[model samples]
Target: MSNTSTSSDTSGLSAGATAATIALAVVGGIVVIVIAIAIIRCIQKNKMQARNTSMQITSVSAVNVDSNIDMVTIERFLADIVKERPVRFTTQNIIDFTQNFAQKLGSGGFGIVYKGQFPNGVQIAVKVLHKTQDKRAEEQFMAEIGTIGRTYHINLVRLYGFCFDNTLKALVYEYMEKGSLDSYLFDENQKLKWEKLHEIAIGTAKGIRYLHEECQKKIVHYDIKPGNVLIDANFSPKVADFGLATLCDRDNSHISLTGGRGTPGYAAPELWMPYPVTHKCDVYSYGMLLFEILGRRRNLNLSQAESQEWFPRWIWHKFEGGELDGVMTNCRIEHSNRDKAERMCKVALWCVQYQPDTRPSMNSVVRMLEGEEEIIAPTNPFQYMMPFDGSSSQWSESRGYSTSTATTTNESEANILIHQNQQ
Candidate 1:
């Protein structure tokens, strides 16, 4: 072979070898980075596992529990939920999946709700819960689910599972064709057309009644606004958010020591303020829902009475005096059922009465809405109205919520909160 030809072949071979080495080095560096990241993650995960193990709650005393009761229904509900075998979301899955066609449902103390569909052809509503990285929030979220997962009522929203494996901690629910009652009732879709609104009202009343009377334990949904309620394909109302529910025995006080959880405008002031309350707080929220149905979400601000300082009082007065026609945004529907509208308005007012004693049980509410029983006019509402500016003190004492007897559980103890009758 000629020297010149041999040298040319060797030179080409050397260049190719150099290129391959550089490529291999680049690949090696990438692998090292990935390995380092994975190792750090493993160490962090171990620490987290250790921390969670340390924080588990062991046991708690029931303010009043019947030890001899047969727990068949509760067991059945839990069995059904477990059979579904929902799992948490992993960060990798979210990164790989693109959220498709999400519509904003609502927002509150919780983050937000968006409607989305999975690639597997499943429709889901995702509730991005409010709290982030807070242990207390995690406890509350679990409390709501654990309590509700024990039963599947026609009225309650269906929980598929949750996503807690990573930073993506959110609740996954079956998508409802119709969004929250709040949007439907107030929006220009002419939602509060009397017939549709009335039907919704009846459905919601039935759901609440189930919570009160049908369930093994009474669950008080402190927040019952339109947003918390959702409509199905058949337009049946399903109570959506269980975030603020308190489950307790029926015979016991609805609230034991005191305090209630709900939105500011809808919550019964007396129950929320001085504490010690019952299902009446829910009744109050229902009243507000009724108002939303009839008022068509008109009064973001309710007016007050002469003695009644709160704005809800103002809205109530105008409603009773038949000023609803003027204030109602969905007035066009009244032409079809004026008397029906009037009856519903009266029922709404009755449920919202300031005194818990006067408010009807959810059973009564359902019956009244169905026209199976007549709804009587509520007694004077402001009877418990504050006499002085600091009337909060007297009201607290009178309502009888002694925090001295409040549930004595530490934050570390993870038992869910339930309410019952006052002893």
Candidate 2:
């Protein structure tokens, strides 16, 4: 009876072990299937991610290609249009000419100007443009090449060649021995003779006249500051820095601007506003430049007495009060140069008139500066700054200006009013 009982127990244990083994196998199969499915899903996810990454890369590459093509097209168009094609130099040539950037002439917002030389001992100023993510630098480069490359004038700086490599972009220009006009005008120690200054002013006016009237297309040099007027060994003035210059059809009454394009103190009132601008805007800038040239100092001098704080305003006061002789005396003008100085002052006033139509053409300015044409006395250029007190004759200190019937109590208020009017 004991043996039979033991046998029954053994049989039951074997059956239970078999059932447990079958359950374990089922669980193992399910786990294996789950792992295989997970692996497949991970592979698909990786492939999808790779595809997305590739698509993004392709999109970025396409954009880069388009930008490159646009630049190339501009280069080709400029080359074709320009009568005298400037020499296209390689990056290595730039490095060699610049002597690996050994002598830096100067630097500005655009880039550095390095003194360079050619094999034949011809001196050049190589302006290496700053690399930009946007196309502004490229646009400016093309503009300089397009405009100046097409024309040649004694008063205009000459662009000899250019390097438009992927890594380095530069412009090769004829070197000016005396540097910029501002160096002499602004420096107390470097005061030029009034006669020379007058000559420079006339030359600058002629340059502007050429741009406005003589060129096939009118090129308005929007930034006509002293810094842009370069002088050579002969003290001859040449207009430089055509980065802000724009070419327009002669028939177009005005040109549209995306934004203001000049030094603040020298910029026209219209440039700050959204008004459709004409070449007269350059006249206004030239007027501001004339103010600086007249003073041999900045337009705004806080160090001066209250009466003479703003040079233009003081000059206007003196001019209107029939004390232009006093202004000439203050500027230390020689007796012989007084007529030229007075002419410059009058021309400046006319150029800065609020109404664009009222401004004299650059041709007229040249004629006036050269004493070839009579300069009619200029009306008050600061009419915008006329006092609120019913008197139209004089500027009052206590009462500020008016813009379109609204009285502005302060300069800031006046600016806002002017901006609103422009809008």
Candidate 3:
């Protein structure tokens, strides 16, 4: 009887322990499932927040683009981006390629560019954006690459790789041996032949046409001065420096902008008017640039004897007087040269028409250059301008301010303002 009681009690204890163990296991499983569900919900919420933030950013950019993003924000955004097409490079790689960035190519509103060579004998140009506490620099870096990466054309600068490690930010591009067009345009020492100049003009037009018509989105190059046009060894022109570029839907013909953009001389008049900008702004700038190329000098000259009259207006006066020879003394009266000069002048005047709608599209400009369409005499670009005596020096009077400041103090301050406003 004692043995039977002891066995029965032992069996009952064993059953109770097994039941308690299973209960504990079930409670633990419930807690694990609940925790996992909470984690998943948290992840979903974070994703939603990110999407909302992106929409907000787009909205803000559409309304007013004040400056580029700060360093921290750009670093984070670049980290999250998966760039499959553009190759990524480390800071060490860039250092090795550039030989510690020894060969300085040039400096601009953006930053200093360095000439680099790879082991494969490929030469590259690395543009390092100016660093600043303001997030606008970061925004410009991203904006430039974003535009370049998506664009592919023989007339457009090719991007190879990028580096964004710590404080270093640079864009690697195929080097143009001949350098910027401005270097040669104003260089009396290396004057390009008339044929070569015409070729460059057409090639540049094709590039701009591509940006405006051929791309998935219409890209407006806010700055189209000679400095931004690069020339390769073969004298082929490729458009570069997209710091002030803006992308719009293919269907949309215009864009709303807050402040101003482009260099003082090359900037369209509408930019100063603070009107709604469009691709035509580029046409207007191209007109100004063409005038520079034709005259082989800056359009506005403060020190000239005729400082009051605008250069374009002066050129128009000479053109109307039937003395093209007097306008640009260098342009000879030879048959081919005269034809080319007259065509370019007419096209430029059309481009710089005070009314934005009067400006021809890049495609039309290309056709006009090629002599495919009938050329019409353009009205004077500055016909409506009233001479200002600097009497009323405020608001509208500021437009007449000389873009070229001789003093160092004013130049430095103007440069800062230009960098903030343009590419």
**Candidate number of the best TM-score:** 2
* Overall local distance difference test of candidate 3: 0.74
Candidate 3 local Cα displacement, residue 105, angstroms = 2.0
Clashes of each: 14, 0, 6
Instruction: Estimate TM-scores for all models.
Output: 0.61, 0.71, 0.70
Against the reference, the lDDT scores of all candidates come to 0.62, 0.78, 0.74
Candidate 2: regions farther than 4 A off: 1-84, 386-423
Q: Tell me how far the alpha carbon of residue 177 in candidate 3 is from the true structure, in angstroms, after superposition.
A: 1.1
After superposition on all C-alphas, the RMSD of every candidate to the true structure, in Å, is 26.2, 24.3, 20.0
Q: List model 2 lDDT by residue over 1-423, tens digit each.
A: 999999999999999999999999999999999999999999999999999999999999999999999999999898656525578999999999989998776554567677889887978888887776247656767888888776688898888889888898888888877767776887787889888888899899899899999999989877777767878779899988776678899999798888656665666778778888999989998998888888898776656787786688788889899999999999999888898999999998998898899999999998998889999888998878643332333222212222211111111111211011111
Model 2 global lDDT (CA atoms, 0 to 1): 0.78
lDDT of 3 by residue, 181-270 (tens): 775666677678767877888899899999999988889988787777878879898888776688899778779876777766677888
Question: If ranked by lDDT, best first, what sequence of candidates would result?
Answer: 2, 3, 1
* Sliding window of 10 residues with minimal summed lDDT for model 3: 413-422
| Model 1 residue 32 lDDT score | 90
